[model samples]
Target: MTETLADFRRRVADFLAHHGCPAGAAPSRSRRPADHVAAARVHQRALADAGLAGITWPVEVGGLGLGPEYRQAFAEESAGFETFSAVFTIGLGMCGPVLLALGTADQRSRYLPPLLRADEVWCQLFSEPGAGSDLAGLTTTAVPDDDGGWRIRGQKVWTTYAHHSDRALLLARTDPGKAKHRGITMFVLDMTAPGVTVRPLRQATGDAEFNEVFLDDVRVGPDDVVGAVDEGWRAATLMLMNERVALADNPIGSPVTLDAVVALANRTGRTTDPVVRKAVADAYVAQQQAELFARRIAGEVRVGRDPGALASIGKLAAGRLATQVSALALEVAGPDAVAWDPADPDGGLWAYGELYAPSLSIAGGTEQIQRTVLGERVLGLPREPQADRDVPFRELRRG
Candidate 1:
């Protein structure tokens, strides 16, 4: 018999409580990739044991075989507590979905179960130094070998959690002669392989949450390929759409930050200051709007409908909202928001958020690209002018 939402929630809550998961504390952040992965693995194991992880995944793949509403409810409730699920966001939110959609039956059987249980963590290996916005212009190459495997050589930057990941979903060009988007293929790479190396990247906040990966002659078997060889562009597009949706739909987990800002205003007696009040109110409104927009898109996706251009709307909205809220946070905090001290009692969390806000606009896709997409696809505007539409990538001038 299927369990109701209420019963599921109660069971999850009880399981968490019984397992000594703390309640009502600030979410944990780790600078060490090993610590982050260890914590995430533990949490995922607990959730899987209790049938809470991968609630919407197929039961044969170590999931509960539930619907998206259940998944949404579980996420919402899980947001109420402090957890390390965010550490595995790329795996659970993006890679897993892509695998489910594009993976072969053997691939799914070999990968999905462990992923659902967090036995192996995954990272996205898509964006390159030259291919952030024009991802199709990526230079990563994969060549077929006599041994029935492919040799890959590439560099992927801004790869989140790569330093800790067990695997990567990699994109590379298999046929340079084909159109930019038509020559690509996606493969699941083992990060522990001898040809793979990951270097941590230090952010402004002094945390190495991101990494740069180098793939030097990394070999992958034919079974590692996801979807059709040349059809990977479509699969990648699907993964990216899901990524934008997930990012936009991320639940606000820092209510304490919001409360802290409000309390600071009240304590400083600046609640009546027109500028301060307006800033605070505006931040709140943006958050609410982002939440609503994300919820609507998620609901549509849950019902088996493609969100299409509305996914771009959500990504654009999230980028704007994150920037706005970070600015508001800094404005409210005044001088304290300049430099963060880890040892400081408040831990300078607001300052960190402020520093990290700019990445949101660039990470999944650039704000400019998203705007062009929305305008052309959603608003029925003319497509952006491209002078090199018919030119070969090799002949195109490097700007």
Candidate 2:
């Protein structure tokens, strides 16, 4: 007795309309992060009440025990509206998946229900000052305590929404004597723990969408450990793969950016400029290509295909296309693109996109890393030589 896709879509649409979810325009001022979280909690509560929030999750954890196609349909239809549920992206995207894949039965029972209902928020605590791309080379340490728990001490940077997170899925070295990747363990750390501190990092766009977190002797019980000790790297890889796939599928674009750029070109009397027209056309083409690739990747995931290197392809294309589209938006806007004053209200959208373009190549995964992954894992290229691959983490050179 499963609901048909069309029926589920109609139910979602009707529920959204009844709740006054924004349909066309960008989310209103009430849709700020804090507000968005609150709204998402409300919406998720309704969704759970209607048995729709975790469409692809198991029924034991309050899901419908449905397939990925149902989740894909939900995402597609949800993208057509301006919903506040995006505030839970990190929770639903990275943390939830990691928990589902690696969490023990007790851990899953304790965490998944609230997560599916958006009652709690989660963030990833993985990247460190020396670790990002070479994540296995992280220096964070977790020592076992007499109380049958662990004391964690470390820093994680580029943590999205750590400032608002209720919990973090953290990675730390449990055995420095083991090889770099073999010594690590993943734990669920309470963000409200006494020594947990968060500082929002302001980006060029003037938004503190990311944060830096410092953990000082934060104690976590044995029950918090996810997967096997020293097996965090595998869990992390799975999460990163999911992250690449989800980021590639992010529906951040609007017809507005292109429309605004076109209007600006016509207003500046540059619509006839051959170079400008070509840039616009090329940008459109790139967007179409990226979208098609993303759609294909989404289809693979819907049918339960492990995307593997295909996710890298989508991520790489997304990064390149973002840069190209943003550059074209700036070109179309001409002189007006120099400043990112949203108050200007006319051409500010183009300027904002241009200003934010550089981040696309770095966020989720760097373009270089994406290409390396694609080449090695996808194309069966020779593996990169690593001096530290078999070295003990404690004996490795710090610099």
What would the TM-scores of all predictions be?
0.91, 0.92
The digit string of per-residue lDDT tens for model 2 on 193-215 reads 99999999988766677899998
Give the alpha carbon lDDT tens digit for every residue of 1-399 in model 1: 899989998887787676635544423464445765676688788888887888888887777889777876766666656566567668987899899989989988899999988899899999999888888888889999997689999898989888888988999989877778888999999999989989989886677878889989998998899999977799899888777556544632332345667887787677888998888888888778877888888777766567887777777776777777777777877877776566886657677777766766776777888888888898999976886575666666655
Global local distance difference test of model 1: 0.78
Clashing pairs in 2: none
TM-score of 1: 0.91
Error of 1 at 290 (Å): 2.4
lDDT of 2 at 166: 89
Q: How many clashes does the backbone of model 1 have?
A: 0
> Candidate 2 — worst ten consecutive residues by lDDT sum?
23-32
User: Candidate 1: worst 10 consecutive residues by lDDT?
Assistant: 248-257
Name every residue pair that clashes in candidate 1: none
